[model samples]
Target: MEFKFTAEEEKFRVELREFLTKELPDGWTGGGEEEGDDWDFELEMRKKLADKGWLTMAWPEEYGGSGASHMMQLVFAEEMAYQRAPGRDQFGTKMLAPTLMIHGTEEQKREYLPPIARGEVQWCQGYSEPESGSDLASLQTRAVEDGDDFVVNGTKIWTSNAHHADHVMVLTRTDPDAPKHRGISFLLADMKQPGVEVRPIINMANNHSFNMVVFDDVRVPKRNLVGELNRGWYVGATLLDFERSGVEYSAGTKRTLEELIQFCKDNSRNGRRLIDDPKISRKLADLTVKTEISRLISYQIAWMQSAGLVPNKESSMGKSFGTELQQAVARAGMEILGLYGQLEPDSKHSPLQGRIEQSYMMSVSATIAAGTSEIQRNIIATRGLGLPR
Candidate 1:
């Protein structure tokens, strides 16, 4: 396999790195978006990225993007993630737009696509429920058509950015009698309505990024529905396909690994630097190899997309292995930090400003979000390996 990036891709990476350096504040580690803090900066950064055409670069030009190649998108995502930049909306730009392009009406596209491409709106995914996370087709959220609207009444848990969302891409069950996978409908619901309630769910890291969003008789216009009615299971799966193809997991882990490497190089234990310890060196080396493998898998996904193919099992491989790699990196950081790894982010003497601690707390959801590791493995087995269901 040819492993080299084209000169143009390399040049874009250089320019992106330069832009980030000039725009970010001194010593910016970009933990604010992860912890759900510093909203104003995030908004400003979002618009800046939109103006620069990096926010939706992979989208087609007719939809307000530059029609960049998927490999270009991979490069962009890697740099943004490695820097921990906060502008890009993964839900809108990455997950929802491509799904809309594939399944939405012209009216739906006109109404929703522009705002997302321009970074004027925030979207939360209403996919996971109290019991329907991994087995998503079994969701119980009901949407009944009444005249011109669908009366949606249900609850979505572990919804990221719901409190700040202007809109939500939701999957609702419309035909209970049908098979679970064939009974659902996808709807674009306005979050500002009175029936929509968002309650906070503070994570163990003391972060409020996740929420429990309750839809009580929420009125969704029929015009907002994407794809055919009772086929939302398929629509939602397409969206998840886009969500799982991201390169962020590997890129973010690469950043974490770099920090851990620097810490080992600078710090000492019993008159010996941590990097000099054979076991520690070996562990880091193993992680390095795994991280590279994850990156190559991501590149393959992008290459496939550039060739105009939809990635089902390929994306699952990327998500499953990349997330596991993320957890592995976090655990390595904690082990290397020893007692100091447990320090809170705000503590004065916390190592790496307690980034490892925060990541360690946050990595618990890496495998669970988007889809579980088991689900990905199942997809690989059934779809990729051609095994029986």
Candidate 2:
């Protein structure tokens, strides 16, 4: 396959870059730290992207989206990551909306997808439980049907952005009698409903991005059911594959690495420039090669998606490698900065706006969240390499 971008695609890329350079909000970079909950920053950023029709570039035009090619979507993701613009909270636009587009009834699509596309609503995922982190199928959160309403009762830990979410795409047990993997259901629950409580779960950075969401007999209408009852495991797994398929790690981490390289040039260590070290140059060269490989893997996934192929293994591999590579790059920055890396954003002389310090902490979470490095390896070995688990 031809790896180079088409003439038209290259032209579009230049135009998008120019637009982002001109339009991106000042003082905004993708990483570092945001001051508030996911909903607030996401809504504002979504408006900026939505106004440009960039949020729905991969979605169909009938749904108020651009119906752009998958390559265009990749371009958009890359540009946004490079510009350090706030990301579209993955639950609404990236994870749930894609599943709804594929499986939701017309009513469901009309009800949910529009607001998400227009940046009018925000959502979070309620999948993992306190006891069921990696072993997702063993989750015991139950949703018993009563007439037209389903009463949801369980606690979901690490529910990212749940406190400020307008809705939650929740995975619940609708058939306890069925096998572990076959008894689940995906339901859209209104976060504002009675009996739904969100308690903050602070992270290593003292930031409150995750939450413990307790659903105490929360009533959700039967119409909120996604696909068929007791078949949510498959649906949720498919959606996760799509969610993990994006190339954020390569694009996003590369941005930080570039910034760190500049930091090395601008800053000093041992009365000399950090970049003057031969070891630093060697590490950067290796990182540059790895970044190129990551870009290739990401482009392959985009090409597969463009060709209407299910990107299961490719996405898994991409997430697996990209995330680990991010951690490596962050560690490299820490090595370069030495004592300066310890100085966080609040410090007066912290390097690169103290981003290296923030990334050093955040990158650890990236490896754990969205499926751990160990889990990704499991997927790649079992599914991609056809190895026995």
Candidate 3:
């Protein structure tokens, strides 16, 4: 695979960097409280990206996208990550839209894709339940067919951004007796409906990005069902593939490493610079190597998509390695900063604006989210290596 970027791609990156430098709000460090407090700002920023056709640029023109190449999409994602931009919607723009393009009806695409591309709607995923965290197929959320609609009754836990979302793409069991995986169906439900409820789940970081979403006798039209009935397992699997494959983790790590390197160069310990310390320098070097590997994996996935290859185990490999690298880098930064790293961003003496501390807290969830590291290992062992389950 060609690893070098074309001149056009490099030019696009430069333009994107310039745009971010000029357009991003002053004093916006791309870090903030994760709740309704930043909704307005996020919406405003997202609209700007949408207007530029940067959001969903990799999608087809029929779906209101620019039909940009995969390399361009990678460049855009990297730039957004580096700049800490708040435009990309993981659910609507990244995961759901691509799945819809492949499995959804034409009407579904027409109704859903434009709003997402225009940044007029936001979506949350309703996959994991209280009982079905990693063993997702064992989900008990039922959607019984009644008249022209399906009556949904169950709860989804650890649902990210449900409180701020306009819609939710839910995984429900449409057939009870057919077996664990075959009985599922994917349904798109309106979050504003009467039967839908969202309660915040504050993590150890004190971040309120996650929520518990409950559906009580929620009536969803049969038309909202995605792909074939009792075949949501396949669609959900594909969504996970999209979720796992992305440049965000690697790009974000690269930015953090850059900041940390500068911090080490500027700061001193004992009588010399932190970067001059062999231990700190060696750790940073190791992290740089891992970060580069993560970037290569991300590029490989982009190349696979461009070549029309479905990434199964490769996505798992990337997600597993990338998340682990994020955690390691965050830990190393905190260790390098010592006492100052433990302080919050608001503290006057905090180093790197306490980003390392914040990342340390957030990193705990990286391995658990979008399928855990354990699950990813299982996929690699069984699917990639063809090992016996």
Candidate 4:
């Protein structure tokens, strides 16, 4: 298979890099501790990306997209991750929009897709509950049909970015008796209403990205139901497939590795550069090889998607390997930095702006989010290898 990018794709990459360099603020190193306080700046940047038709470039033109190719989409994702841009809403643009395009009704599409493509609306996912994280089919969130709405009740835990969301894509049980996975439905619930409450769930990194959202008799219009009633499990599966298949994690890991290598080259220990240490050089080389492998896996998934194939087992494998590698890189960073790695991002003496420290904490959640490593392995074993459950 041809792994190299075409000339046009390379040109697209260069153009994106130039745009990012010109648009991003001076002294910006991609991440910061003040992300939550920069809401206005985030909105402005998102709007800029939207105006350029880069937010949903892979989507069809009727949906406010540029109808760009999958290779362009890969290029965009990699560049965004490398630069650590803060604009693209993962829920609205990445997970929800594609799912809606595939399964949403015409009315639903007209109402939602445009605003998302314009980067005017932000969405949060409501899937995992207190009891149903890994085994999501056991989610207790219930939505009973009213006159023209569905009254939703229950809670969703580990919801990312609910505090800034305009809407929530909630997975609820519409029929409790019709089997665990068969009775579910996906609903677009407005977050401004009184029935919905969001509480922050601070992680070990002390970040406020995660939230616990409670829905108390939340009224959702029946028109907002995505796909068919009691058939959302299929839709959710497709969305997960999209979520798991991406080049961003690998790209981010590669950037981190490059930064770490630079740090090693510049720093010294006992009058010798860290890069000169045989042990450090070997570790860095090992990580470099693994990062390249992860990149290839991501490209393979993208290629499969471009060919109109659903990469079920392949997506799971990519997610599992990429996340695990991320954690490994974080661990290696901590080891390489020694006591300095424990310093928080805001610490004056911390290296790489304490990015390694923050990553070490954030990496703990990567293995569990989207789908756990165990679950991905199960998919690989049963679906890919034809092994017994």
Candidate 5:
């Protein structure tokens, strides 16, 4: 099937590119990762996006969004990833807002979503407990009822942006005796409350983006419960689907590939230009074709959403393929850069500011986070192909 952006959509892409050029300062390449320290700058860029209606472009008009089509949303995401801009909040705008729209009460939506669309509040996900990364329903976090609040106690690992989050969307076991999935409830809690502690966990690349969040007597208002009690498994499942949607993967890969190509052309190895080598040329060609396929797969998921159909295993397909391809591209970059690739960004001799080295480190976790590759394949097999365990 043929696929192309509408003329207006293409124009929006051009306008967005121009806007990014004018708004961003010199040499800004951050894509909103590891940004807690410079949160003021991040907030500034996020509000600019909000003003442009780009932060919540796909949200409905009432929620301060332009109600752009999903395809337009796809284009916007692609451009944002390509430019490596720092304004978008995937947690609030991409994950939580959509969940609230579908499962939240009127009061909940009113209180939580507008600030997100305006880029005024920061949110962190409180899933992925110490024992419940992939087996999320098995989380041990307890939320006991007490008057108007549920007193919470647990620790959540790998809680991204928790240090900078103003609030968190957490999954708690409200009924420990019920079946693992049946007893869970989704709750929103203020991060600044008593008994909440955030400890940073710097990755190998030395970026302090992930954290471990500890909650002791963190009281969530009873009214903060999302959807029906003990049914948040389904609600959280919906949010997970949104999380795995993979447009940013291919777009980021495209950026890396472009830079790698340019690097090959501009530099030399073994007394010759790297791009002229037969093996390097072939590798780049293969990655180019695979990147296009990955891009198309992600686009298909967005198209399915636009058609009002849930993507299910299709999301897994895009995520797995696109993420693995990211590793492949980074590996190829290291091969071309050779020993120099090992240098960190701080090293004066490091190539490409050591982005390839960091990409290599970050890509290892890409296949593991959100959900693992093994888990994704299980989903594809059981859901998409109708295979049984």
Candidate 6:
């Protein structure tokens, strides 16, 4: 289990890093919990990746993919996050691309994959409803069959990036009589159609990254259905597995922690550097250990993927460890900065352009978004430890 990259992989990482440096705009850093505005900055970054044949790098070559090794893809993610490149819009690339590759027909692949790869269109996930968050199986969004379309009527809350997305991959109750999971169908809907409305939800950071999307008898083409009828749960699970794959965030979190430490040493408050404090030092040490552990777990998941093994337990371990470690690092950052951490970026005297303040606020959401900390624990207990529910 030596996790060192091969010479070729090292070279690949450097090349991608250089490309990102040259292409990413001067002020464009990847959006995190605290990156102030949406501005579709990631769409432009994604297009750069697409132009370099880096977007959809893991997909098979026939469908606009380089078909690079899975480990290479993981390395790319690490480098991108390390550089603070715009956080990827997972709805299109991470979640839907894999689903379409697996469950979509040849026609669907030809039609959908290229635009997504090119960043010509954006997408959002429409999974959670007002009533369904962790208990997603209870979603009540319904889609009834019509002559050649499905008339959809439902509301999806916390639809990340829906305000900017060109389309959404939604889960709807296509068969109410069946068991909750079995009755659902995975479908795609055009966001610009007659009945779609997206309302922004302001987070604690006063940003509109998440939205509530309302569908008022929206008409979706029947061809948009993915996988078999009444089998959306399986399709959705595959996408979630993709979401939980690899622990790329560990390296980036470690890097950010290093930067925070440097900031503490350089900044003096009441004539004492924050790094001199015993509590801050101990917290950093703990976070360092946790971050390294997360990195190892992620590498294990990457290795399993290379061997064509399903990364059920390892994925859960990586995501759980990586996210928890990030939250810990963010907490430690706030402790080091003390009062200055409260200043917003717009203030004239804020430290690090208010980066730390934003990190603290956004970190609170990290444990809740994607999946909650509680849900991750449940997943690990049930799947990794083989515990009965």
lDDT of 5: 0.89
Model 5 over residues 1-389: C-alpha lDDT tens digits? Answer: 78878999999999999998998877876543344547777889898888878888878888788889888989888998888878778999888888888899989988898899888999999999888988889999999999999999999999999988999999999999999999999999999999999999988888999999999989999999999898889889888888888589899999989899999999987799999999999999999999999999989999888887667798889889989999999999999899999998889999888889989988988898888899999999999999998
Per-residue alpha-carbon lDDT of model 3 for 267-337, expressed as tens digits? 89898999999999999999999999999999999999888777889999999999999999999998999
Question: Which runs of model 6 end up more than 4 angstroms from their true locations?
Answer: 25-41
Error of 6 at 211 (Å): 0.6
C-alpha lDDT values of all predictions: 0.91, 0.83, 0.91, 0.90, 0.89, 0.80
* TM-score of each model, paired residue for residue: 0.98, 0.94, 0.97, 0.97, 0.97, 0.93
Q: How many residue pairs clash in each candidate at the backbone level?
A: 0, 1, 0, 0, 0, 2
For model 1, what is the error of residue 362's alpha carbon versus the real structure, in angstroms, after optimal superposition?
Answer: 0.7
Alpha-carbon runs more than 4 Å astray in model 3: 33-37
- How does candidate 3 fare on TM-score? 0.97
- Model 2 clash count equals 1
Scored by TM-score, the top model is 1
The residue-by-residue lDDT of candidate 1 on 112-195, one tens digit each, is 888888989999999989989888999999999999999999999999999889999999999999999999999999999989
In the order shown, the candidates' Cα RMSDs to the true structure are 1.1, 2.0, 1.4, 1.4, 1.4, 2.1
Model 2 C-alpha lDDT per residue in residues 1-389, reported as the tens digit of each score: 55787786788889888876775556656444532434456567678778878788888887868888889888878876767666476678778887887778889998998888887777989998999988899999999999999999999999877877899999999999999999999999999989999999888876788899999999999999998999988889878878887877788878888888887788677798878888998899899889878988999988997787768878778888888898899899888888978897878988777888888887787777767778888888898899998
Report the error of model 3 at residue 57, Å: 1.1
Pick the winner on lDDT between candidates 2 and 5.
5
* lDDT winner, 3 or 5: 3
